[model samples]
Target: MGKEILDLAEWKSTLTAFAKERDWEKFHTPKNLATALSVEASELLELFQWLTAEESTLLPQKNKDEKLRKNIEREMADVLVYLLRLATVLEVDLSKALQEKMAENAKKYPADKVKGLSKKYDQY
Candidate 1:
């Protein structure tokens, strides 16, 4: 098991320290971070590229492959780390942004009207 991070601030601080230690902070511009984020997200998505729906859902589960699960976990962590770094660089409050977006989503896709529906909010 790995050490637990208590909150976003801790994760940011830890990642910042890591970058600083490696003298990599200079390359962590918003654009670069966003690009890295996209690449990492793509890598994560690639992990399930050929699996059927059930196989995708059961990733590293049906087969009980620790290496597969670890690969997925590492790719996911890379994506998140870059996202957090980008948010930090842009001075964005992710928590507040998520709250606002969720509120907008609830209004746009009210459960009473869109229950069990898969259409886009604008479509319905």
Candidate 2:
């Protein structure tokens, strides 16, 4: 393997091993993992706190700042890690859950009715 392609199973196993080695499974409850995920998401959002809508959209390329990019990447990794850990702890199939949720959303916001419209499903 060139760089050890990291699929969902590999990521889960890696995370599981890390947690097990540190004996942190006791504290990795669903609620705690969810809270940590939220906190990491907030930290990611803070990176664009002072930027305007347009500025925020172009943050990754327009700024050309490696440090800011790295910070955002790190925060994103944190969020993903927590999400994966939470799914593992809860025995939730992440891929299946994503597919099911996308199907639900498609029904809620059918393309024919919601195309080019930025309205919530209820509003539509």
The candidate maximizing TM-score is 2
Q: Model 1 Cα displacement at 96 (Å)?
A: 0.8
| TM-scores for candidates 1 onward, in order | 0.90, 0.90
RMSD of each: 2.7, 2.8
For residues 1-124, write the lDDT of model 1, one tens digit per residue. 9997548877888998999999999999999999999999999988888878987677756457677788899999999999899988898888899899999999999999999999998898
Question: What ranges in model 1 sit over 4 Å off?
Answer: 1-6, 60-63
Clashes of 1: 0
Compare the candidates by lDDT and give the number of the best one. Answer: 2
Off by over 4 Å in 2: 1-6
Tens digits of per-residue lDDT, candidate 2, 62-83, equal 4577788889999999999999
Q: Which 10 consecutive residues of model 1 have the lowest summed lDDT?
A: 56-65
